[model samples]
Target: MKRLVFLLSALTAMSANAQGSKKIKEKDMPAFTQFTYTGNDRIYNDNPLKEGEFYTPVLQGCYPDPSITRKGNDYYLVNSSFAMVPGVPIFHSTDLVNWKQIGHVLDRPSQLKVEESRISGGIYAPDIKYNPNNDTFYMITTQIAGNMGNIVVKTQDPAKGWSDPVKLQFDGIDPSLFFDTDGKAYLVHNDAPPAGTEQYSGHRVIKMWDYDVKNDRVVPGSDRIIVNGGTDITQKPIWIEGPHLYKKDGRYYLMCAEGGTGDWHSEVIFVSDKPTGPFVPASNNPILTQRYFVKDRANKIDWTGHADLVDTPDGKYYAVFLGVRPNEKLRVNTGRETFMLPVDWSGQFPVFENGLVPLKAKIKMPKGATNQTGKNGFMPNGNFKFTDNFSDAKLDYRWIGMRNWRENFVVKGKNSVRINPLEANIKAKSPISGLFYRQQHATFTAETTLQYLPKSEKDLAGIVCYQSETFNYVLGLTKKGKDYYMVLERTEKGASKVIASEKINPGKSVKLKVAAQGDAYTFSYTADNSAYKNLGGTVSGDILSTDVAGGFTGSLIGLYATSGNDIQP
Candidate 1:
């Protein structure tokens, strides 16, 4: 009963930050920080670590649905970029621990048309595999929003660019490419059976097709069902997706994720002698999961699945998969993150039972493993802290926009970035125009000084703590009925509600700030460039989390300017 009372108090405080003191309940009159952080957030490494340990999140932010390849000693990785322009991000590493973003597979506008794509509805999972026989790198993926169903793009040197996409006929999402020791190649994916019937909601079948290298397409009339509705059709293992085929010791192995991507999420495996399987499920399924990680533990790692396996040049096995760290009450704020785990085949089948936490791996450094640092020279971990004066003629490479390009609005000045408000408002579904950076940490303060005081009440320029078009919090200065007011607003499902507002005297500029603590955030502003004052009631970061926003991307902290008056004809 006490816990429930405190929770209600917390909710009251958060709502007050959104709806103002009048809506604030007397039970929560006191301003208190409700959320608690567990502290796994650190973006970069400060010192060189022993070979037994390495920094995680080889690639950070909304880079999900990862695909990896190894060419000789070099390792190449690509993650699904979704609606963001410059689609699939391609990364390179020598040891698979230290990765550098070499380029993006979908760099050309001609290759993909993501105009007005919902944040969640864009590119799906992608598979990056190398064919030594052809000396080429092949990438295949499903377009969630634009283009045809599934497409394959290739490149000889990925650093340069990739060829135009070649459409592949596959009825599924997570498309993967696998080459056999022999000349034969195969493509495996999750799709509804030919009968198009299912026992349960997540009952998707794994289908296989002969991939023709010569024609660069699936062989005509060669679709086969490898595993019928998961390990067993009756038990009905749900969401048996993200299949990766491997051949080892002359046995074909297929590994996949089961249980929808939530608390029940896990990795499972099957083995067969042929490329297409009469496969047998391992007795020990759910090879990787955090469900057993002690729910009440201090460090909580949950939602572990969507994995891709890779073998180092030295024949060592490792896996890169998506995992999440919930902030409070199992509400996730960081979105799904990339985590590394060892493939313990010595056990029954193969599994990483310890779950999502990064382990102290006892492995030799690959031939070309080198430590890479961010622009700030910090080592990589969970928290990525970034600050830019915007003095350069162009925006930093780290900042990304929605459907539009960041270059369109980011103009140069002496020491500041001058942004022209987009004709569209941020509340619109038509991808909002904002220059955003990933909110890598659960708790950090973001502050920006803006010089604009609106000539019209319609000018809205400020710092946005955003998840999607439907979910965001804005703290900026605007004119409310001829009075310059500092307003805090919460936008959910295209509706914007003012939480609090303070009428202030007009100045040359004002500094807006947001401090995140656990799942909650506090917004403040300073017109004098000093003496910050709280602007709104505390707000929940989970509101902007992918779990609430419904997307494959994470939360982004951005500088946005929208002419609320600028509506379409």
Candidate 2:
């Protein structure tokens, strides 16, 4: 009877192993359960489109500073793809809700050096426009930190390919192009005030000058300061930037994103009879914003504006803007995600009544629009669960290393993944052992169990919130002599702030869980896998915009291990 029972148990174990192996394929992974992962929610409902639904981000991994334009019935969108190779990832959509990546605009290395650049310094916001006369597409980006911010690029046919970056001598960032009805092209850009001056030039005025397409330089034309800074209804200084010109109903609408492009700032519109504006704010300024009042709800997420407006083939107008999905639980990976909203015209000005919409499960395409489909190399839904008995030719797409990756980071021990510390300190250069994925949701929980052998006081291992090489947060285990410390390191500036640290008795295995409820996150550790205690809570930094940091990408959550000096596993 005992032998029979043992045989049953062994068979059960084998069955489990086989099932797990089959599910380890990258395609089989589930979507990351972040804010944007609305498993059963519908993208659009029966009601007239609401605020959050239209602009809720479909893709969660760091798509920011969106610039969108319409070509016939098709809508093409591009966002800042900083530091990642093949920058300026272009996406397409028939209905604004369901989006698919078509291709990247900057694919050549000569166009930009993306691999070696820092996270925030590579590319700024890019504007996409279709030349009506020639039916060509143009893209412009600001390469910050490289050439004293004097960088520009253009392409005649972005869908086919992009030309080498035609360097334009510009002083500031956020470069945009305006093609007037008179067959003349103009460049609208922002510039800082003169040296030692407190008043920045671009914030108070939108400078307009002729653009020389052949030479890729701003011509010596009469410069005009169309708009000036002033106090709005809120009586705050209105710093205007991101100027886009549209002529409608024989009136010129000069729309710009305002409020310093942070939380509480918004998309403000102004109108004038002429392209060069002595413009007046729309009676209803700040046409779109997420700043609403609801009791018991925290309005911690800020700066919900910076938009690209497009008109559909049917003459229906829409605006694509950026807003953060604040999870009460703080399990957010979708930071400043893209949202779509219908633009309604009241008399001569534009009005946006719909507020921010939360992400939903599936959204339908616009009528008569064809769906464009493509694979994202990695799984679209970034759920990172896989059983690796380790004998695979390559690591899973879900796994990413810290500074440097090496063969010794993982060891196949029978049918388990054995992770060891590559360096003692988290600050060491290229700690070969770390795995991460883009944070997809604003609210969710991530938990993992780890077994390790600590060899020194500098050894540490656990999960981390990686913004870049400089800014990040770590919640993991650190070793001191024979004891262990559950340490949380917040990296900002050039130093590490240990927010919470708890010592533990020597143990062979530990389970770690990090729960993000909204902007607040809590870390917990358990030795028995039964009851867990909260270590503490921390907030995610405001690092998504072009002001605080310049990049289109968002944050990532992953695993890490560090050895101060010796290699410990």
Candidate 3:
């Protein structure tokens, strides 16, 4: 199996190399000396977090479709990566307030085959569940690319590693595994309506299957539709997805996200007597949503849905879901983020505490625990600064690659990191020689210092603010004739436009910086650590928004190098 995977990867790389993009020798590639990122969003910086209060959106920046599970005192959380290599980032928490990213569930090339897919085509809505019956953990998700449909992978401990994916025999998205106390397992997911029963656009149904745990497959004929058209079939609620099943107090409860994944997104609940049954919608219907809120609100957080629930050892319930914090212009460049709220499952159905109201920027810490944001290696929140000198051989898990991660391009030294230029540029849908970090704040600055002398006009290396293939900004040092120039290029709807350019004599070191103040962005560069000069005065960040880009991911700031440089100024 390992040999087969190697051959497949080699073939894919060969095919990508045949795209007529220029290649360069490894010795002449660019080496980045340092990279620094700082997040200073006004919402986080201005607001004072009182004692015992932490900022919401625990896991920020494009980490959408959150699914969480608890095993005794340990809590494990997983989020959708969507075509990024090493998909399904798994995080661990002991007190729910302080969380740390352990590792990715799909870490190797054999486990994830997404070398040729687009940035948003690989993994979607991964659901992680722990079954005490077998003392195992299962992660199930839909692979939208690579022709790998719904798949499942298991592990005895999440920190060690996960098994190779076991393809499930089912057709749907957002699949979740439910373990009943009776030793029976079940699977629930969002699927299309039955044959010829298609009603309207965005109409979807929730289906359940009797999962055979011994064989790791769904039973042959146990598929049944649990809910049709969301809360009410007659009202025609649309895009009912991200479903999960839970049993409490001798009753089965079904929860799903409804009304699409935009501002109208919401979470609804239903009840049934059996795992697969005639489920009835709860009177409260949408247990969580921000749809009713008026537009043009202050510090707005929108598109709240795709939730999962987990109970603590002491029986306290909490929910984790996805929401977006848009800029003042109502543009979402940070993408769908993960937020948490305590649940009021004390009733017949669960309700997200303050989930229905406008989301608050701060929340009180859970009982007996203090806020741990940015402390003890927990994922940082509010305003923070991160600097990487590339002194360690192992890269941080926050740095990711699109489609596939190539080992040849990255060379980590004692003080710097060199990237062998790839033929594939950022404009192509294929994998490029770039290591990306998601834009975690609405307003932040990313800068990198590199040593590079472009061999020709075909070579370039610098930083990229990438939303997708057609929506991004590339600021790099490229050569024209015999002079070196720093050029900033913008691609909107697949058309490239040169924003600004300036000729410079970068002697030994050149620093490039991309700063964003809400919707406005500026690109600046300095030579030999001299005074910075603005290459692009300021440009609107609308192009980096999902509303304008039409994708399922947030902006990724990357250390990029490519031999096939096409943008010129």
Candidate 4:
């Protein structure tokens, strides 16, 4: 009876603490809603046979290259923010599946280069870990624009404060920290060897060296090769990267993502007796991949792998990784998003049964987590209806801007959202006058019916698979003399490629639908939902990386209006 009373008191205190905060103002909210859906939610519910079922993207919209760590009962994750002013966005969760963005690690201009760096190249992967001895949380990141190998920062109280970033002399892309039981710290990195030398090691190799905690440097005498790419190479030209380490029982486990991070790549697990020695591959290599699941719709898109593992308070293990769902017809946008899976341990080794399987079914929330539902909801699952009458007092989290925004693009009146052409063309200097959200699930579809009023030859309006100004897939109506032309442009390759062009009459409203099943994408036009035809050309490869785009967010599916002259939609 005494223990029960104490438990009740504790709960009461937590409730009070949670209620202390007030709702953030509409303008003060983060630039992008972390997990807004760009497609139909039915795609994630299409698969019902997978074990443990499947959930929607927990952290969406440019929430790629995830690095997760657990400290006691709390779990923390940080993702690469790239050119966004605040470099790395940090999220915390009690349950491994549900996450909330708490703060950004680098909030100062000195830590991030937003003015000069392209949107997609500012920040790379970041690894988060807690140092128990010092009682501090440490974050390591790579500044692609600065061309610096890695940078480290720490905070004693993650909720309130963080230290300035300290540069480290390490030549690698994705850098992770492994704290051994003996209190020794080691740095594991994907070594990018000198170019054009066959003897030089590939990115797949995991190299380890003792790190000096006080000086924040790699110790000279502690360098050693831990895992080699030759043993677990993916069937792609790009080598493996993103190495994360964990130790269980008497064995050290190295789990890294393989494949070129495209359609054929995936995650692989290896084990060894020591931290710096030859590691043996698990019986089931590519332990977590969609390659073997031929019939799964989620596998249809290129499911390249990059993963981070974390354990729950109850001692259960989980892995968070990145995957993509491509649309062949509208193939310009290809930013990877986050996905979660449960990990089962057998004896000393960890196993993931549902390897590379897409989330096509509803999943029950873990014990103690809340499940909230709405059209543009806060929960991990659920679809957002992009169709807005613009009746609300303010824009919903479902909408994100394509570039640095201005007040001229949207005018919210009493009944609907009026989108005006801010620029002359889709590829113009002015902002793309539209609201967008990321493509969340692997097999969903997006449909938008738009009416275009082109004011000039440069005037156009329609839906786009947006990454950056250079990397996007656009299908819009452009004014040509007295008529309108339906045009398809592929910008993923940096240079725009006009894939398809057709003439049509202006002022007619047309319905556009973009469908995605795995890596396969199809774009269709219809006056009605029942009839459709395919557009040509498909986008794939590193061109899909966030490094190519300028947005701090992911690929967005939104309406855009542009013109050299004045036009409104």
Off by over 4 Å in 1: 1-51, 346-348, 353-379, 382-384, 392-394, 412-415, 565-569
Q: Which has the greatest TM-score? A: 3
| Candidate 4 lowest-lDDT run of ten | 26-35
- Candidate 3, poorest ten consecutive residues by summed lDDT: 12-21
The alpha-carbon deviation from the true structure for residue 534 of candidate 3, after best TM-score superposition, in angstroms, is 0.6
Candidates, ranked, lDDT: 3, 1, 4, 2
Candidate 4 regions with alpha-carbon error over 4 angstroms = 1-38, 44-56, 60-62, 114-120, 194-204, 230-238, 293-304, 326-334, 356-370, 373-379, 385-436, 441-464, 473-554, 558-569
Better of 1 and 2 by TM-score: 1
Error (Å) of candidate 4 at residue 415 is 13
Model 4 vs. true fold: TM: 0.67
- Against the true structure, what is every candidate's RMSD? 11.3, 10.4, 3.6, 10.9
Candidate 1 local lDDT, residue 251:
84
Best-fitting candidate, scored by lDDT: 3
Compute the lDDT of residue 555 as modeled in candidate 4.
Answer: 62
Please give the lDDT score for candidate 3. Answer: 0.88
Q: Per-residue lDDT tens digits of candidate 1, residues 1-569?
A: 66664564455334323321223233211111111122234322233356545555555556677778898878888777677766777777766767766767887766766666887767888889999888899999888766567988998888889998888876788889898877889999998866656777778888899999999999989998888778777887888899999877778889888887887888888999778878999986767877666665544667778888888777777788877666655666667767676666654365663543433312334455554445333225444445576655444555666765544444444366545455566666554556776666666777777776665576667788878878888887777667787778888777778888788874767777788777879998877867989977787776787777776678777777765532111
The candidate with the higher lDDT, 3 or 4, is 3
Give lDDT per model, in order: 0.70, 0.57, 0.88, 0.61
lDDT of 2 by residue, 1-569 (tens): 66664554345334323322111221211111111112111222222333332223545556778889877766788887655445677876666655666567866546765433566567777788876755767888786633435455555555567767777765666778877667778777655444564354333556667787666678875566665553252354555667777878877877777777545667777787877766788766667665554423442344567787788888777777666554444323455566556666646866653544322332334455443222333223322232333345344433444323323344323233444444324443323445555566544566666665445565566776666666667777766666767777677653667777788752556777666644666777776666876775655544321233344456766666555422121
Clashes of 2: 44
Per-residue lDDT tens digits of candidate 3, residues 248-276? 99999989999999999999988999888
